[model samples]
Target: MNFHLLRLASMALIVGTLAACSTAPVSTVDPSPIPELLPHGARAGQPAVTAAPATFAKSRWLPVTWSEVPGFDSDTLHEAWNAWLKNCERPTPAFAGLCSEVRRLSIANGDEQRAWMQAKLQPYRVEASNGNADGLLTAYYEPQLDAARQQGNGYNVPLYRLPAGFGTRKPWYSRQQIDTLPEAQAALAGRAIAWLRDPVDALVLHIQGSGRLRLVEPNGQVRLVRVAYAGTNDQPYKSVGRWLLDQNLVRDATWPGISAWIAANPARVNEMLWSNPRYVFFREEPLEGLDAQFGPKGALGVALTPGRSIAVDRQSIPYGTPVWLSTPGPTVALNRMVFAQDTGSAILGAVRADYFTGWGQEAGDIAGRLKQNLRLWAFWPRHLTPGSASN
Candidate 1:
């Protein structure tokens, strides 16, 4: 077994058991109310929701290295991925249809990844960071290159684009940077290697679910890859309790008893059982008696307002710090938002974030399209601390 799995399993069993016993349910409502946005220019309508006073406390900014994080071990991470996959449900007709397409593509060729992204995904026009016009969304459809081989193979992909000067330094990557700087070369090359080895795994856990990889052909042909996509799923624990109570599966259906019944379910044989929709997907964060909403694209785009979102993390990372994201997989670009407004279940951590693509079939299409690496680097007020709260 992967060492990480063993550790996480050991830890989770304890947490899971206790989680089943907790008196209070997890709160879904944003602890702090969503602040109303001031009109971009002037507005004739009444003022939008007023901004809440910043709740984040001051802390020294620390560069938390993701690769060094113990829980990020590949095998353990793989367990989580496989778990999510096995319990994956189509949140909408478009997503469900996309899943069918992905399954179909999977059947024709053993390459499930490519089938989902190419034949299955809906395409959109996009612009490169350099203002070059291109496909808005590019889905990577090939295996990643080994680290050592990436230096010689320049095949690369694009993920997402951020406003220029978004990070701490200006011109984050100069035109001649890759060829001129050894560090940049190593970083870029290391990225290529990581993606080729385990594109999906690398992207989801380590890279903030974003990044670019190279798909080099023996014939020396290369193409751009994109992996920005998302799908909806249940917040199992909360959902399970609600489901059971709603269906009269249990009496009272409180967190403790409901959780115990869930854990005790004969089918939950491994730690991966957490992925079961009964416990994973939630209608809301705190188990509010509300049904989860499905927007046209998905929740991320709704929360972030993609084109209109901005940074705002007062406690952990500063509100304006520019960030650089690195994920595992082939993508249209490298580097995306460190603090996008959109959010969801799987996306909850001080160091974690979600990039909204759109909703419904569009969102489902985007979710199906993802398979890459993502890295983040904060720009404004470079001197900020990481926070404890992740939501």
Candidate 2:
């Protein structure tokens, strides 16, 4: 049995408020731990922390040393990336540039691949582009798991796990490893440099917690997305979590124990937890008025993922810039992108953004009620348009 399944089974039988079911919250240890990907001690609790999309910071921009780029020759991983690209459709503007490059490198030998990589690096040989590429990219932060007994709004909310019977090899790449590989370093460094030095264009959005979503595709198809916020409301690894911990909202001192308590409670997870005031999620498809998903699960695909969507703002920002969102949370600063274009449902004017809240009741609740102002910055590649000049 999978690890989460065992917990789920035990939780299914429980019935009561989360607070009623657990003993007095225990103090946790290690008080704060470094996040999985970000720099050590970089968390959300501090106010006036250096602002991000950091696309303009020279300090974060580093040169890509030659040794840092990876060798694509005789490398299975490189070949796999090429293979994946072959399956994706072409002629779309997004892949046109990469597609051409792929074709040239497809039949090249080791020596040829090296030469090609060098040539590719010739034009704007620099490290880190911030986070902008021609296409788009989004960051998905795995939320903190709770293990306590305090039931509230998110009670009975269904938490979706990686589907059963699906096994795929997990790939782990260390920052050090990437730094040692020239090509990989160059590419990532280029993007990171791009993000850090440029203004944002696209802002892809995703949220943690349970809610319904509505995706209105270009072809007029609507899909549903849902997630359940069954754990404590505090966004761990964020400034919010730190504050909540200080405020006693996070009574459990340890992450593991806290998570165990949440799993045990199986109800009203969101009510007692810290939340993002800037974001308002829905219970069902906003358009359809459906019920929210129950239990401790969520669907990022259907809930936060947008469908064939594009956004545009003519005044304050330009078109075609990729945005890395540092959401209204405490922990991780880099979120997803919301593309920039010339059209949308409710998005209009400068500094205005319309996030694709997915489809359905949950979507309705979140999108319909969201009218408050939120802080967000843009990112772009310095090459495409210098960050300072663009902003």
Candidate 3:
């Protein structure tokens, strides 16, 4: 989980009592962080940040008013209720008391739900310790792709599961090493879960962590299944997109742009794949096309809500917390309540969040193009008797 923390109420003073014990008691209270307001130019497509979003020097939670959250009231809170319910399946002990109430409120109207929030939760705006509220918001999604039950013809790329003794050593094998080395190939020889045509498609699936694979069996029968994250080779993840950018080969850095570059430089595909030594393995699960609509389960171990689920740095925001997010610009103007249900490698920083854009091509389009400004307001249970809690 992302490290997402606090204090107690003052002791009441007795009035008109023996009071020579005076000087107004210089209490050593650590000041609550003051929130930073977003700049006027802040919008959806680009960040209006005062500095680099990733330069993250320091960050903290600053208590904020619900009014300061742009679409707090107007938002369809009920829309995110399902996401909240999913959170309860493995909620932190601090939120145990409110799960029942949240379930009940799920069936209520928006205004009624709004009332519940107003009464039960307090908003804390996430900001840099230096007072920068503006940060970057990218997105991720589940992608569905075609596969072959047996390797042949146009379908030749193999997506393998962990082979025996693979985890015994650290940094088992890099992507290029796995493809070229006999030892690595031996481990995966008889363990091909499925095969695909484009190496890039498999790479995309690996990056996303989970996806639906439409398999064409030996008998020409079609089957759909999910490939969930199993394990990684323990190597560091390198950004292929960044490599292309640094090489001056792609002007637009989105997925589409990268795909176009790949098509032109087909011979360099392995180079791009090798750029990231990190390799992920997967385990297949049964999934029909219709069932895939609900979205694959996220890091929270619960099915994600489309457009309502988000991936935050587990170090900053706990897996099951609810967040009020507001980030507007050219791509999309989002002011809604989303659950922090997942986390990612690239998603780092206190205010950093990745909007879960759901599944398929459309969601992929949004996820690919999304690189905008973001701000967050975390809603925590008021009755949470604050001593210590994940943020």
Candidate 4:
């Protein structure tokens, strides 16, 4: 599992409460303006006066024309509309007014959407304060696993909910303590939301912060449910993959390599599990009808649209912002619009992002190996000054 952890509600509150500031150093480079792309029969209006470069806490935004964005004209805007609509659900003050028009344009053609964007939004090249445009991109996905309401047969590992008085302990019991200590066990007694067959799957669920469980109830009814991140044990997160790499136990530190090592050395499974001190707690959520089609609710408190949702550092890019992501990759090349509807502990930087691949095994496979070079462009409303939290 890639490090897309810590999509907790508390983190969302932090992002939501950041006061808008424009004190970071701005870039001095200026590219010549290019002609805007417009739909057929659309009249050319007076170009909006260009504004000075804006600065956020960790990033600098340099205004650029629509033509500068790679694959901007080619992307199917409607495909990303679902994510945009999700952003509208709890829109930042800057984007709240655009929701209605965004809703109306749900069925708009690519050309029309493109035209609308050009008319209403400004494209700004996102970069670090020191002016580096190149950055890294990783991917994360929801895992699906078979679970049971009660531990039995092969379902020996328990996925627990937050314990009573969990807040009293500054740092709750470590993973090993939770497994071995009677006191910790007592606190977690009767707290198993579901039981899984493999401890590795439990670890993956912990890392991904949410997953879909094909849960068999006590009554023998099997229903699909979602386990979402409620909180953590307040321990520091250490990567087991990094530990394996450091120990020289595995050449590939991805999930597959880790799984292979675990299979070969079954006795040391606990050793590997305990390498990461952090443990996540989850709460069960219903998965029914159209809800089943979406991924877990992100830190933005909205259902993440698989290919179009990305977890970004809120200091660099605010939640609910529309971002244009471009990456040339050995794993997968992408040049599309994605929404910044999630945040992660590991996703920290102006250009760094974690692409949300949809759930299941295939999504998991891609997410495990997807780390690529990336460039980003953020779209802001034409009327509002960039970095301001107002319409």
lDDT of each: 0.27, 0.27, 0.68, 0.77
Of the pair 2 and 3, which is ahead by TM-score? Answer: 3
lDDT of 4 at 241: 69
- lDDT order of candidates, top first: 4, 3, 2, 1
lDDT of 3 by residue, 233-253 (tens): 878766777777777887766
Question: Can you write out model 1's per-residue Cα lDDT over 71-151, one digit (the tens) per residue?
Answer: 122121221122112212322222332345434443343234422332322211111233222111112111122222233
Order of candidates by TM-score, top first? 4, 3, 2, 1
Model 3 worst lDDT run, 10 consecutive residues? 5-14
lDDT: worst 10-residue window of model 4: 17-26
Which ten-residue region of model 2 has the weakest summed lDDT?
193-202
Q: After superposition, how far is residue 98 of candidate 1 from its true place, in Å?
A: 42
Off by over 4 Å in 3: 1-58, 246-252, 288-291, 385-387
Number of clashes recorded per candidate: 79, 108, 13, 0
Q: What's the TM for model 3?
A: 0.81
85-150 per-residue lDDT for model 4 (tens digits): 988888889999899999999998989989999999998888899988888887777888999999
Report the C-alpha displacement of residue 347, candidate 3, in angstroms: 1.3
Q: Estimate the lDDT of model 3.
A: 0.68
Identify the leading candidate in terms of TM-score: 4
* lDDT for predicted candidate 4 compared with the true structure: 0.77
User: For candidate 4, what is the TM-score?
Assistant: 0.87
